[model samples]
Every structure is written in C-alpha cells, then in structure tokens.
Target: MLSAEEIHEIEAEAQHYPTREAVLIDALRIVQSHRGWVSDDALRDLAEFLHMTEADLDGVASFYNLIYRKPVGRHVIHLCDSISCWIEGYAGVRRALAARLGVDFGETTKDGRFTFLPIVCLGCCDRAPAMLVDGELHVHLTPDNIAGALEKYA
Candidate 1:
C-alpha cells in the first residue's frame, strides 16, 4: 500500500524512534502525506510494520483530528467553532460558507474542490470567526468577505 519512496522516508524517520510503537504517529503521517488519506489497506500495512494491532493503530489515528480516514477534496476548509468565534457571529460565517459551497461540515463539494470541516480553534481568537482554507488562515471573517477570500482557493 506504500511506495518504495514512502517506506524509505518512513524508515529513515523511524530510526530516531526507540520502538515501532513510538513511531505510530509519524508512520501514519508519512502514509497520509503520500496517499492524501489513509485507506484501510494502508492502515493494515502500517499496523503490520509497526507490530501493533489494527484496532490500536486505528484508535490512535482517529484521535488525531488532522489524520483523514476518508477521501477529501483538493482543498480542506477548517472553520473554527470555538466560543470566541461563536460570539463573533460564527453562525453567519458558517451559513455564508455553507451557502457558498453548497455543502455542510463533514461534507465535500460535489465538484470535489473543497471539504468543509469544523475545528476547535485556529488560535486567532483576537481575530474571531476565523477559518483556514488549505492551511491559509483567514481571520475576522464576515459573510460578505468570506466568499472573496475563498475565490483564491477555488
């Protein structure tokens, strides 16, 4: 499920680890970096390589919010839903985004261009109602400006 280059990269990183179990997160990240998202086959291979049960590895993988288990679009939209954002009109921002993308959180656009997801925070509380589009942070959002900000990603 992993390519030679990916295995080589993962093994090189694994050298610094005390044991295969310690390398769990990095191994999964390596697989995700190469494959976009970790498939069942890839997870199985990783479990074997790490000498851990698939269930154990899956638990770890699922715990990390950044690790995607299913296919995602080219761009991932992470909307902050923390109290600061909530107080700063997060509902309007979310509504605007939902209307713009025609997809709700945990759903991907039908055109496969974007995936909308909710994150706890982006640590931009001063600039509340922030969102990250493919890692580019947009803060102090309003419904009017959100669409323009997303145009670059589209």
Candidate 2:
C-alpha cells in the first residue's frame, strides 16, 4: 500500500498533469525516493492507486533507466558510454571503477555501497569520460581520480 505521504505527494504531482496516467513517471520517482527502488509489490500498489495496469506501469518503469526495479546499493554510479566518452577513455575509467569497486556494470558492490551502470550519454560531450554518482555529475574523469571522486559519497 502507498503510504499517506506518498499518496499525498503523488496526488500533488497528479494535479500538474491532465490525467493520473500522465503522472506515471513522477509517481514512480516519488515511490522510489521513499523506498530506494520499486519492487513488484510496490508497482502493483502504485498501478492500482493510479487506476492503471501493472503491465503498463512496469513497461514505463523498465523503459526508464533511472527507475530501479530491484534493490540498489546506497549509492548508484552511472557511467557514460557514448561515443564522446569512449573517445575520452571510458574504457580506462570503467576498468578502474570495476577494479576499485570489484563489480561490473549492472552489479552492486558486495558491501552494498555502490551499484555501477552504464548510461548512453550524460549530454556533456565536451566534458567526456563523465559519471554521475548519486545524481551528482563528475566530469573530466580519469582513472587516477576515480577513487577521489567516489570517496566523497560515503
């Protein structure tokens, strides 16, 4: 069941849209903000609250990369893999992060501190080889500075 606070927030967001279904993405974000990730049960409850089908809600959730369906670590790392990032040495950064965190893309650290994932682009082509740690953009990254960049999160 959606909490009172969650419902209240969702309702407030719904007012900005023409229909409840239009608030689907915001609803998912609101729930995820409170719960960390959206589970099957939560999706079902949210769908019901929005008068939508589970399949519909799940489709939106799956299509959006930011909407985590499974449990994630305390911090999520999104590394850009666009052509610009690749040209700017994304491979080295990926290797450094994997070696440092001991987890590949789509995997979370054993201690559940970080989850690493690849994004198509962060839209900062000029500052390639960038990553977002818990939504904070870190641009102009190199293999050497990854440790320092990650240190501030924990």
- In the order shown, what is each candidate's alpha-carbon RMSD? 1.3, 0.9
Off by over 4 Å in 2: none
lDDT against true structure, model 1 = 0.91
What value of lDDT does candidate 2 attain over all alpha carbons? Answer: 0.95
Please, what are the lDDT tens digits per residue for candidate 2 over residues 1-154? 9999999999998999887799999999999999999999999999899889999999999999899999999999999999999999999999999999999999999999999999989999999899999899999999999999999887
TM-score of each: 0.93, 0.96
Cα lDDT computed for each candidate against the true fold: 0.91, 0.95
Which residue pairs in candidate 1 have backbone atoms (N, alpha carbon, C) closer than 3 angstroms, thus clashing?
none
lDDT string for model 1 (48-104, tens) is: 877889999999999999999999998999999999999999999999999999999
lDDT of 2 at 87: 97
- Model 1: ten consecutive residues of lowest lDDT: 1-10
* Number of colliding residue pairs in each model: 0, 0
